[model samples]
Target: MLTVKRLDIADARILIKGASEKANEIGVPMCIAITDESGNLIAFERMDGGKVSSAFVAQDKAFTAAAARKATHEYNAANVPGNLAFGIHTEVGGKLSTVGGGLPVVVDGDVVGGIGLSSGTPQQDMDCAQAGIDYFLQNRG
Candidate 1:
């Protein structure tokens, strides 16, 4: 048997706020999601004026990051053209995305959750997600 830390709502809010701050700094509206290790959504936010379609994308991104335990772009880079996993986006019932906005949340060297953001360019999404992940890492034991 094993025990692992779970993200509480307060922490989820912290992540959301951190991500929102970054998005505001970049002047990008965002849809953000947080999920637990089992790929279940814990909290989510769609900022005012964010893309209407980005909510689902953000949720799937968080799910993929938590279940896959890697930054989403890492999958994209490793499974590049001519690589073995080039068409991985077609896998996992087409739910896995190798986009820039997804990141696993690690605490004490264990992936406990993930954060995802959408409604911005890939770089903007990554920047916002990274901000939330950094805050989680800094505040967790």
Candidate 2:
């Protein structure tokens, strides 16, 4: 049987800090969320100027990536055009947003969690998420 590991709150904190630092450097307020592999919320933060609406969206994005075990954009891209997984966003309790800023957090080639960022342009959001992922990978205990 295959086993899946879960992310602890300490790791979640690390991800949030990394993402926040990147957002601060870019002068963009952000909402960052982390979720365990099973799509449960692990941690979240919303900077002072981040849109309140982004909180839920960020959480959903993180959950979707973690549950799907793929970057949301990849899922969207591969599912288009006659693919049954197409419009999966509508089936996953409407929790999946196939946007460009959410990424799955992998460990040992297995997804263990996910990170999501919002409140900037798509590129900026992706950059902030990448920073978080890098931090997690480098600092893993």
Candidate 3:
């Protein structure tokens, strides 16, 4: 038999709270999402004044990060013309986002889940998502 770690509600909430706080600090409304190891939605939030389009984009970013076990921006960096992973956005049922702001939630060197943020500049989104990822890594021992 094999045992595995998963993202529970408590951990999910921690991620969301951390992400939200970062977004608020930047004064940028955002859509935030967290997913389990399988890229299944664990929790989500669209901040007031956040763009509606960001809701799905945020979730997709989280899915891409969780499924790939790497930051979504890494995909963008690799998928440029003549790059190794070109046309990857067309794969994965179009769920892979080439933009920034998605990060894997790693615990003990294992990707337990992912968090993504949208509805802000790419840098802002990355910063907020990174905040959540950092908090989880710090608290989830």
Candidate 4:
């Protein structure tokens, strides 16, 4: 038998809160998404003024992070033409993302979930996603 850790709704909300704060700090309204270890969404938020197109993108980012257990940017870095992973973005019914905003949420060396943000530049989105993880680590009690 195998045991797995997953994120609850409360954990999902914390991720969204931290990511949103960073987005606000950076002056970008964002779409934030949180997913359990299997890439199932737990919570999502679209701030006022956030781009509508970013909604699904954020979810896809979160799914990639959680299911792949890696930051989406790492995939982006290795997705160059002629690379074996080049077509990964088209996998999983086009749900996998090679963008910079998705990060796995690790707890005690185990990935418990994922966080993803969109509506800003890829770098900005990555920053907010990282901020969300930092905040969750500090406040996971």
Best model number under TM-score: 4
Write down the TM-score for model 1. Answer: 0.93
Would you give me the overall lDDT of model 1?
Answer: 0.87
Q: Per-residue lDDT tens digits of candidate 1, residues 1-141?
A: 988877888878888988998999989999999999877899999999888788988987888899999888888788789998798876778778888899988877888888989999988999999998877667644
How close is every model to the real structure, measured as TM-score? 0.93, 0.90, 0.95, 0.98
- Please write out the lDDT profile of model 2 over residues 22-91, one tens digit for every residue: 9999999999999999888999999999988789878877988898888877876866879877777776
Winning model by lDDT: 4
Which 10-residue window of candidate 2 scores lowest in summed lDDT? 72-81
Candidate 3 local distance difference test against the native: 0.90
- Once superposed on the true structure, which residue ranges of model 3 sit more than 4 Å away at CA? none
lDDT value, residue 109 of candidate 3 = 88
List the pairs of residues colliding in candidate 1. Answer: none
CA shift of 79, model 3, Å:
1.1
- For residues 1-141, write the lDDT of model 4, one tens digit per residue: 999999999898888888888998999999999999999999999999999999999999999999999999999998999998888889999999999999999999999999989999999999999999999889877
Candidate 4 has which clashing residue pairs, if any?
none
Using TM-score as the measure, name the better of candidate 1 and candidate 2: 1
Model 3 lDDT tens row, 1-141: 977677998899899888998999989999999999888999999999988999999999999999889898898899899988899987778898878999889888888898989999988999999998777767764
Better of 1 and 4 by lDDT: 4
Residue 98, model 3: Cα distance from true site in angstroms: 1.7
